[model samples]
Target: MSEEKNESTKDTKNKDKSSDSKKPSRRRSVGIVLLGVLLAAILIPLGVFVVAYATYDVPEPEEVTSKQVSSIYASDAETELARIVPPEGNRRQVELEEVPEHVQNAVLAAEDREFWTNIGFSVTGFGRAVVGQLTGDGSAGGGSTITQQYVKNSLVGDDYSYVRKARELVYSVKMTNEWSKEDILAAYLNTVYLGRNAYGIEAASHAYFDKPVSELTVEEGALLAAIIQLPSQLDPWNDPVGAETRWNYVLDGMVEMGELSAEEREGMVFPETRDPAEYSAYTEATGTNGMIKNNVIAELGEVGITEEDMTTRGLQITTTIDTKTQEATLDSVEAELAGLQEDARAAVVSIEPGTGAVRSYFGGDDATGWDYANAGLQTGSTFKIFGLAAALQQGIPLSAMYDSSPVSLPGDIVVNNWDNSDSGYTTIAEALKRSYNTSFIRLQDDLYNTTQDTADMAHALGVARSLPGVPATLTENGGQPYEGIILGQYQSRAIDMSTALATVANGGVWHETHFVERVETSDGEVLYEHEVGEGERRVSELVAANLLSAMEPIAGYSSSALAEGRTSAAKTGTAQLGDTGQNKDAWMIGATPQLSTAVWVGTADNTSAIFNEWGGNMFGSNAPSAIWKSTLDGALEGQEVLEFDSPGQINFGSAPNQLYYDPVPAYTPPAYTTPAEAEPTEEEASEPEPVEEEPAPAPEVVVPEVPTPDEPEGGGIEIAPGLVIPDFLTG
Candidate 1:
């Protein structure tokens, strides 16, 4: 009985220990269950919040719904120079059916393999993209579906930020729901950027292959699809190797997508592309087309048409460029300068004197992107016509005489004839015909208004009254009209000079120069039409006639004349490069009764001299003159040779007192000798006695004392009252 009781107590103790172990295990299980419940409570709501945040209300796509196209036309209003289509609404949009099945498949295979079945956002793609952003690897991965990419590119923009990504996600879902798959695909194809400034597939097709989209082969379509990755980098013209590699990749992708078979891919080779020059009008901003485009844009701005209006409102511009004249001018310059040095450049501008219409122009090389016709350069002796006009306006006749010898003026300024070849005295007409520098300097000084009046005359005639590249302080004196003003020392533009000379040909009527004759909308509504014959009377008809008479001999039968039988008046100019001892610029400006033209030849660098090995040193009378002659002859081939009207009679005052005289040879008479015979008259002794009574006082004469210029403190010559010779001239 005692052994049985001890065994029972041990069994009870074992049960007690087992029960205690069960208590802790039960508690652990309960704690795990509660923890799981708490996690679910937090995570479910957070996931909902994320989804709600990314999928909230999205704005409608309004920008791509409407679009327009702009066109530029020549003077005839029939020839199209250029068509401007921006990257957004201005691009050419086509329907989904219009895109070839293979082309659509290529884009789908390259961009999104599961575009047809996948949701707007893929879970795997999103996770990978998040990882990429966190790892700081830009090219790591992208989570955007076709719809998501469209939203990012068109709506929220491709900003690498969490907020923009969330917005893109939201818009993508909304866009997928709101727009059909076909609509989304069409929008993407139309809005995407391709190479060579192309905005759409059709434009890209034309840009790369010079063909329409419907004409593209399967290989061409694949090439365009590859460019979607990076358009500028994969341009076929600029990067053929990269473009071909990407094209092959796209072709392989098409094979994997079942759109193209392996056999088809194997047979296809990278197609050859047209040269970029073939599509230069679309790719470049430097050519004849570029000039028209740029000028059209500028004119649109002048009339308060915004650039947005130009691209989106579908404007059609009509220019005043006569195609025949423009071609002739360009050909003449290129032909005349065919053998010129590599850096040499030339420009020409022609205008209708009556209408102020810019008929023709050549602005350096077509690819230089510089409009030298509108650019400023030293005018040289071409500016002398303005001074001559000033003199003529003040009743100074062509017969006014000036001593052509070198003379000293106020402030000790010295003027000399060209090559120091002294002509004793010359009339105004003779001085102008020979380009006598001394005569013009003296004439400017003798004028009542001096250089100030000469500048005014230039302004009236149509030259820009201000000198380019001059300081404000110096330009204050009517464009710094110092003694050099008479010699064309100021900067002037070819267009301005041509227009000014045209004023003389137009009988003193100064018309504002312009290039656009009219502008119209695509619907044929005239937005602007330039009025003709609007000009101000800058000079009397008499003064204009007198000026023409003086200039006639310049284009008469001389070697420098533009045409032998053509009634023309012209002046030649050559300016020295700053201290380089080389002639840098050469010019020839002339006018018929109908057209006025100006030509300039020089180095584009503005530093190098225009030296010719075969022709010796180039001058205004040679190359530029020849170019003008050729251009005018071609431009006015069938036009009538209008006669310049004769000038009305005007009486100039009597000849002024001679300010200078040549020194006569000194006379030394033979030494006085005693007279051989003396014959005394009775009146000689009587007259001597009467003269001794009173000596009449000699008439008093006043001679103004001229002050000599003091030696320059710093090694410069003070040429005028406050003007100093620039360092370039001192050398």
Candidate 2:
């Protein structure tokens, strides 16, 4: 019984052992199944995510488009650009078909060979990328396809990382699913950077080849494609050799990829030179007058353009520059100032009357340095233009009379004429036509001192005050004040001077001067358009007409003038520094129906003159006059000759008005004899106001009629058209 029981117990023990062994195997099998299930769970979801993202369709990127440039309309070459208003900054969009096939093929060959077949990221390429990242050796190249690149540009910024790459891969899959192959190609071309300030293949092709993308030759296409890999590094301009090698590499790749026939590849010839004009939206002039460059830079702060924007970021500047007019202006100044640079320095400015566009500007400078033309300098007789305007705004007229003799101011300042002599009496027009210094000084004391008229007039004409009485550093006579208000002594830029002159030309309208006409995105969207605004009128039309007419004697027709044949109105000035015999400033401000310009000739140091020599002839007419005449003749070749219209205020149909001032005594004074007759001549003694031989046909008066006071009140003035008192020469 014990043995049987023991056998049963042994059997039971064996059964328990057998059960434990089976339990161990079962647990192992269960563990194996659980591990397999875990593996399957992770792999299945990952595969689904990958497949979904890769196969998921995404909307195509919007086509890149650019705004169009309007054709310019103008006969003047200088205003050529002004005629064709460009849609400011443009952004070009390139189509896949527009891109040369080689360009597409080369980019694919260089960037991703398996782009068509791969699922965004090639497994072999991904492995290579991983190894490359680990070893810090991205030189092994990238595996992201063009579509991936486009996706990265669109979705991801510029961060290059494994995670970003993974995201890009997913986006690429979606992009491929959503966009067609053509769309992807367009996006790639649109996003790629071409050198020479270009952002895309289209802009690049335009820049490098001076043609549209579709017109690119295989060589040009290859060169551009090569630029995409590293624009700055492979730029043909800055890195010609490297770019050439890279270009050849692209060609070789195209050949190897069978994208280019052997004959086409063999025919390829790399370009040796790059013309900046090809890409620049602005037409370039080899003979550009760069005098305005300095002033433009000096006032960049005022103009709202950063220097960095000019140097680094590609900027398409559609300036208010008229190359032909600019050339004429420079030539005029150059000719005018020829051989007389030693006596004084001169500058010239020309502005469009209504638009404030700088149609013609000439600042003296070599091609490499700062332009002194725009430098703020002491204005001599030109200031009278504004001064007269001031007095006229107060109802003064050309017939107004003034004492033409020297006058002593509060500071005992006694001023005289250029010859240091003065006439006993003169009219407002006579004072201006003679350019009498004493007359203007007394006029200033009388007209300006009472109502701040000089200041008002200066401000009205766009003359900014000198800082705390300090003038421009490069002014005549070191910014000294002078008694001759008629003779300019204040400081201002040539551009501002041009604008001021233009105000008269535009019938008292003051438009802010501008260099840029419009701004637009590369795509033809108008960002900004400038408008003309009326500024403070320095004088009424009658006053301006009076002033304009007063300037007529400056041409050669007048005894004291030099400029000939040109229907021009002008003023000349020679100002010496007060209290010092040092610096002298010379100027010629003149204009025609087609243009208004100012010419200044002097040295930067204020010491040298145009000819490095001196004689009696130092006024604007000597050198500056010649230059102005020559330039004007050449520039006005095909244009009709026209003169500024008399102000609308003048009514010549009215009855003759009496003289504004008392007439001089009818006796000949003994001391007022001419130099040739220091002693009285017998013939003069016998001469008499010979009885009027029948009414000697009323001598023709050259002056235009002054406007009546009733004209639509433009500036602040309201007085009748009768001869008024002349105050410019009388205190």
Q: Per-residue lDDT for 204-292 in model 1, tens only?
A: 77777887677788998888899888888888778889999999999999988888999999999888777767674344234555655
Cα lDDT for residue 223, candidate 1? 88
lDDT of each: 0.68, 0.54
Candidate 1, poorest ten consecutive residues by summed lDDT: 708-717
Provide TM-scores for the models. 0.63, 0.67
Question: Which 10 successive residues of model 2 have the least lDDT summed?
Answer: 711-720
RMSD of each: 17.7, 14.9
